[model samples]
Target: MTPEFAYFLKVNVAFVLLYAFYRLFFYRDTFFKLRRTTLLAFFGVALLYPLMNIQDWIREQEPMVEVIQMYSAILPETTITPDNVPETDWHGLLLSGVSYLYWGGVLALLLRFLVQLSSILLLARKSKVMQIYDTRVHVLDRPAGPFSFFRLIFLHPGSHSDKEIDEILTHEGTHVSQWHSIDVIICELICIVCWVNPFVWLLKREVRHNLEYLADDTVLESGYDSRSYQYHLLGLSHTNKSATSLSNSFNMLHLKNRISMMNKKRSHGIGRAKYLIFIPIVGGLLIFSNIDAVARITDELVESSFAEALMPEAIQLPIQLFPAVNKEEPAEMHRGYVLSKEELAAIKRAEEQVFTVVEKMPEYPGGQKALLKYLASSVKYPESAMRNGVEGRVSCSFIVRKNGSITDAEVIRGVDPALNAEALRIINAMPEWSPGEQRGKAVNVKYTVPVSFRLANKHKASVSGTPAKGIDTSGRIFTVVERMPEFPGGQYSLLRYLSQKIKYPVIAQENGIQGRVSCSFVIGADGALSDVKVIRGVDPSLDAEAVRVIKSMPKWKPGVQNNMAVAVKYTVPVTFRLQ
Candidate 1:
C-alpha cells in the first residue's frame, strides 16, 4: 500500500482504539477537564505520528553490510513483434479510481464546511450585537438557544428570564473562555472529511460531550445551584431547528448524561494515570506504520550490494568450468570395453549422482550472453542492500537434470544474507537449460554460478558521448537512493535553468504539439549524466529537444547509497507549449 493510504488507515485505527478505550473506561468519570485534554491529544498525536520515519531508527541497530555498488541502464532489445505487445494493466486503473474517489470525498466535505461557515457568518450579521457583562453577544431574532461560535455567543434574550439569561450567559461564556467552539469546529471538519469511518464520528461526539461536561462542571464549581441550572438547561432546550451545526449550542446533545455527570462526585487524581496508556498505543502505531518502510530499506541495501558485484572487477566466476563443452559429436569414437553385470549395475546406481564433467555441458536456450541477459533482466536489485552498501559474491549451485529442467538450487557461498536470498531467488526463477550429455546420452549435471555484488563506477560523459575507461554500461538504472542527485543549486534553480535554456521545437510549435515529454536518465557516481531517453514522448522533435536539453545539463551532485556515490536513475518532465 502507498504511504498516504497507510497513514489514513493508521489514523483511523488509532482513533478507534482511543475512542473505544475512553467510552469503556473514562467516559462516565467526572474528570471532565482531563478527559477533554486526552481526547484532543489522542487526535493530535494521530495526525503527526505517521509523518515520522521510525525505520531509520530501527536501521541504526541493524548490522552494516561490508560492500556497496552502483548500476547503469540496460539497453532495450529491438526485437519487438506483434505478439510481444504489452497488455493493459487493470490494477493501475483501479488504484487511480480509488485515488480519485478519496480526493472527491475530501473536496465535497471541504465545500460543505465552507457553506456551514458562510451560514454562521450570515446569522451573526443579521442578529443584533450587545454587551452582556464582559462578553459581546449576538441576540438572535429567531429562537436558537444560547450557542457560542468562537468569542461571540448567540441567544434569544427576550425568550428567557433575567436570571435564566445570566445562567445561559455563564454557560456560553465558559465555552468561549475555554475555546470549546474550537474543538467543535475541529471535530466537525474531521468528521466531514472522514465521514466513511464510524469511529471518527464517535470521537467527534465524544469531544463535544466532554466539552459540555467540562462547562457544566465549571458552572457548579462557581457556586451555581445544580438543580436550578439543570432546570434552566431543560427549559431552553426546545429543539431549535435553526441551530448552527458548527457551533457549540447549549443543548446540543446528551442532556440526560450531562445532568447525571453534573451530580457525580469527582474521581481521585489517580484516574489521570489512565492517560499514560496512550504512550504505548502511539508507539505501536509508529512501528506498524513503518513496517513497509523497513522492508523497502532492506531491499535497497541488498540491491546496492548486488549492483556493485555486477561490475567486471568483482566477477570471480570459475572460468575453467564456463568454457563451452564440445556440442558436436567427438571427431573419433573410442574403443569399446566389455563390463560384467555387477560393474554395469554399480555404474547405473551412480548415474543418479550429478556429474561435474560431461562430453557436452548444459546450455541456456541461446548462449552464455543470453543467460547473462536473463539474469540481468530477471534480477531485482534489492533497495535495502543498496541503502546499506552491502556488496559481495553469492555462489549458487543447481542441478541441470536429464530432462533439461533446473532443480535443487542451493546457495553454496553466501555474502550478505539479504543478497544471498535474492541471488538464490533469481537462480531458482531461471528457465530450463539444455541437458548435459555423457557417452552420447543425456545426464544430470551439477553447475556452480557465482553472482558478484559490486557497486557501479562513475562515468565521465553523457549517453550520446564517449565514457571514460573501465565503466561497463550494463545493469538497470535505479530510481531511489539515500540522497537523490541534485543540480548544483537546487530544484528551483534547476527549474529556472530549464525555463531559460529550453526552446520550443519549431515543428512542434507549428503542429500545435504541446504536451509534457518525460525524460529518464542515469546520473553516474562521477555525477556525469547518461542514458538520456524520452520515456513518454509528445512528438519526435519535442522528444529530441528534451533529450538534448537533458544532455546539456552539467554534472549533478551524485546520489549516495551506503555512504558511497552510486548511479541513480531520475525522470523529469519537459513541457512544450505554443505561446
Candidate 2:
C-alpha cells in the first residue's frame, strides 16, 4: 500500500478499536467530564499514533544494509522493444474508477458539510439578533435550532413561552461556556476524511450524545429542579425538527438516554481507575501499527525456540550433498560417516549464524565517508555493459563474517550480467570491516549494496544557476552510510509530506513540461538539510521549486557510521506531473 492509504487504514483500525472500548466501559458511566475527555482523546490518538515511530523505544529491527542507491539521469536511455506489446490491464482501469468513486463520495460529503454550515449562517442573516434577558441569541422566524454553533445559539423564541425560552438558553449556555461546539467540529472533520468507516460515524454520535449529557447535567445543577428540567427536555424533543447537523441541538436524538443519564446516580470515584487503561490501550496500538517490525522480532524468537531446537547443537553434513547408497544397504549408511562430537561442535562454532540486526553494525575501515570515496574511486564501469547501453542499479549482498572478512558475495537483484559481475567483484575485493555484535559476541551480519551504472550524459551543470552550499568539495559529505538520514516519521511520512507540500510550478504546468528532477543535498551531523542542488533538471522553474520545498523540510535524524553522527549526501527525485 502507498503511505497515505496505509496511514488511513491504521487510523481507522485504531479508532474502531478505541471507540469499541469506549462503548463497552466508559459509555454507561456518569463521569461526564472524564467521558468527554476520553472521547476527544480517541480522535486525537486515532490520527496521531499511526504517525509515531516507537521502534527505537521498543526494539530496532532494521538490518543495516550498505546502500549506494543513486546515479540516475546521467545514464543514456536504453530502449529494447519486445516483438509483441502486452495488452492493457482492466484491473488498473477498475482501480482508477474506484479511486474516482471514493473521491466523489468525499467531495459530496464536503459539499453537504458546507451546506449545513451555510444553512446556519443563512439563519443568522435572516434572524433578529437581540439579548433575551442576559444571553445573546439569534431568534429565527422559522422553527430552527434550540441549538448552538460555536457560541451562536439559534432559537425560535416565538414558539416558546418565557419559561421554555429560559430553559433552552440555560441548556445551551453550558455548551457555549464549556466550548462543546469544538468537539462537534472535531468529530465532523474526522467523519469527512474517513467517510466510509461506520465506526467513525457511530463515534460521532457518541460525542454529540456525551455533549448533551453534559449540558443536561449542568442545567440540573444550576438551581433548576430535575423534574421540571426533564419535563422541559421532553416537551422540546418531539417538536424540534430544524436541528442543524453541525450544531449541538437541544432536542437532539437519543433523548431517552440523556434523561436516563441525568437520573442515573453519580459514579463512584473508584471508576476513575478505568481511565488509566487507555495508556496500555494506546501502547498496544502503537506496537501493532508497526507490526511488520514486530514480526521480525518474533521471527527471531521462533527460530531460536523451535527451529534451533530441532537442529543438533553441532552441524555435521556428509562430504557429498547426495549420498551414494544401494537399495539393499541399511538406511544408517546414508546418514553419513559420522564425525566425533568435538569435531562436530568445532564445526558448529566455526559456522555461527548470520544476523540481520545487532546491537551495533559493522563499520568500514575509517567511516562511511571513506567507504563512499573508496567505492567511487574503485568501481569501473564495465566495457560490455557500456557498449550495450545497459545501465541500472545492481543490488548485491554479502556476509561480513565474525572474523570481519567479506565472504559469500553475490548479486541478489541485478540488471545485466556484466553489471552484476562488476558489482560483486567490487564487494569481494573490499577489505575487512569491523564486525557487528549482539550481546557483546561478534556475529556474522549481512549487507546489501546497490551499485548504479548510469552513463554520464550531456546535462553537465544544474539548470537553476544557483549553486548548492557545502558541495562535496572536501570529501566530508557521504552518499552511502550504514544508516541514511530519516525524516521524523520515516519514508511513508516523508513521501506524504512531499506530495502535499510540493506544488507544481505555474509556469511549468502552463508550458506542459513534466519530468522527474533529481535533487541532492547534505544532511548535516545535526540533521539539518543543506546544499540542495538539482542533479539533473527538467526546467529552471521546476528545479527551483523542488529545491525550495526540500529546503523547507524539517530536520532529520542524522546518518550514523561507526556509532557516530555524520553528514550524508542524499538524493530525492521530485516529479511534477500534470494530470
lDDT of each: 0.65, 0.68
Query: Cα lDDT of model 1 overall?
Result: 0.65
Q: Largest lDDT belongs to which candidate? A: 2
Q: Which tens-of-lDDT digit does each residue in 1-579 have in candidate 2?
A: 345876888999987899889988898999989999999999999999878865444432323110112222332222223347576767679979988988898999889889988988887788899999788998877875488888799888887889888888888998999999899889988898899899999999999999999888888888788988888777777775555688888888777998889889999999999999999999888876655333333322222211101011111111110011111211110111111111111112254766755667677788554665556656676766555545555666677788899987877656789878877887888999999888998988875554545443321122212112222223466655554576764443565566677777788778867655667899988789998888767789888888998999999877766556778877665555555
Q: State the lDDT of candidate 1 residue by residue for 316-391, as single tens digits.
A: 1111111012111111110001111111111222447667545576888896657765665566546566555555
Model 1 segments more than 4 A misplaced: 60-97, 296-579
User: Model 1: how far is 536 from its true place, Å?
Assistant: 36
**lDDT score for residue 84 of model 1:** 54
TM-score of 2: 0.51
- Global Cα RMSD, each model: 25.4, 24.7
